[model samples]
Target: MEPQLLHGVADSVATVVIHHPAKRNAMTAGMWRALPPLLDVLAADPGVRALVLTGEGGTFCAGADISSLQGSPDEAQRLAQRAEEALAAFPKPTLAAVRGHCVGGGAQLAAACDLRFAEEGALFGVTPAKLGLVYPAAATRRLVTLVGPATAKYLLFSGELIDTPRALRTGLVDEVLPEGELGKRVAEFTRVLVSRSQLTQAAAKEFADGRTDRDAHWADQARGSGDPAEGVTAFLQRRGPRFTWTVPGPGSA
Candidate 1:
């Protein structure tokens, strides 16, 4: 099949699949540009309460298509950083369900998500050093935040692959599943994510990402939102809460 990003929404979860298995799912220049707008559409859809990013077939993305970088590595970096920022800023819960290799730009995309789950034996790397390209500054900061300065420097400087065990220990990946179990766990976790309160998740996501000025905004959101009340009622009644607050699409209040 042709290389592309395939996406679908089911049961309030939007799944974005990276397809390019011929080159181990490496993304081309066009795929880099396609990601942000696709994420926007999904983020804007009220039906899409959470998102999962993954690769097709066995392997996750190996990296950028090296051939695409022959023309201009700078342009590739630009598009990639843009895509990464978009994923990081996505208001709802986002998870990277990874298998096989998640290297270079693929690792950047995965790190942008709120959480990452890798299958055992999956390998990961941040590989700008291999191409002699300076990784984007914001991307570097994000990496540092995820894995701390020492671990981040190790990946950024060495450009060597780390096994899933080390990645998990360093907080690069949130969970490492045994082979054949990654998909099941991602589905189960994302179902729980969509069942929760968007008000709480969105606020917590922003705060966790270091946007502290939004406390007042979220406080107002909670006041207007019925989720808090519903949560209490559900606990008192011993039933699951049907949260009513929905995240507005980009640019909407």
Candidate 2:
């Protein structure tokens, strides 16, 4: 069966599932091509507060489907990079709920997400070295940002799988849960994110992702949104803040 990227939304969280059980959810070129548009749709939805990327059949993605590598190699690489950039640039919080193997491009995708929650038995690796291919510079930089240069080199040079504990220690993963608890824990965390102010989250995500220099527009947004005042009032009143700031589009308010 062909690999697929499946998506759905519930309770303000969009779940994107990589499905290819036969190849351990390996991503095909077509799957890579499909991701950016799907992410665009989800990101444009004001009701969707967050996104979760995972794999079906109890396994996360294994990497690019090697068989497809024999054809349209450049297109595949380009699409894969586009997909990764889309995920990284997504305005809302994004999480990777990982299980089993997350290697090579799969590891790259997870690294693009804001947070990673892994099952205890999950394995991670960055394997371009094993394939005699160069890892993309942008992806390499993202990996370095997540796990530092030394650790990124360790994964890139060795192409060896690391367990969840090492992943957590290296900051590759935010949390590790037992086999049956990952979903519940991720859902709980997403609920907390949903309840928070989207304006604050968006600003923080942008600044945290290496946007060191702030522009005048950022300050304008903070003042215009009124989220800070609402947050403070809600805190004093011991209630949840009703944040009504929707994502701004091209010229829409």
Candidate 2: tens digits of C-alpha lDDT, residues 1-253: 5679998999999999999899999998789889998988898888899999999978899999978655666666777789999999888999999999999889989999999999999999999889787788999999999999999999999999999999999999999999899999999999999998888888889889888776566788879889889989999999989988767753343
Regions of candidate 2 where Cα sits further than 4 Å from its true position: 70-72, 250-253
- The weakest ten consecutive residues by lDDT in model 1 span 66-75
State the C-alpha lDDT per candidate.
Answer: 0.92, 0.90
Per-residue accuracy of model 1 over 148-245 as CA lDDT, tens digit each: 99999999999999999999999999999999999999999998999899999999998999987988899999999989999999999999999999
C-alpha lDDT of candidate 1 relative to the true structure: 0.92
Q: What residue pairs are clashing in model 2?
A: none
**What's each prediction's TM-score?**
0.98, 0.96
CA-only RMSD, every prediction? 0.9, 1.5
Look at candidate 2 and tell me the lDDT of residue 199: 83
TM-score of 2: 0.96
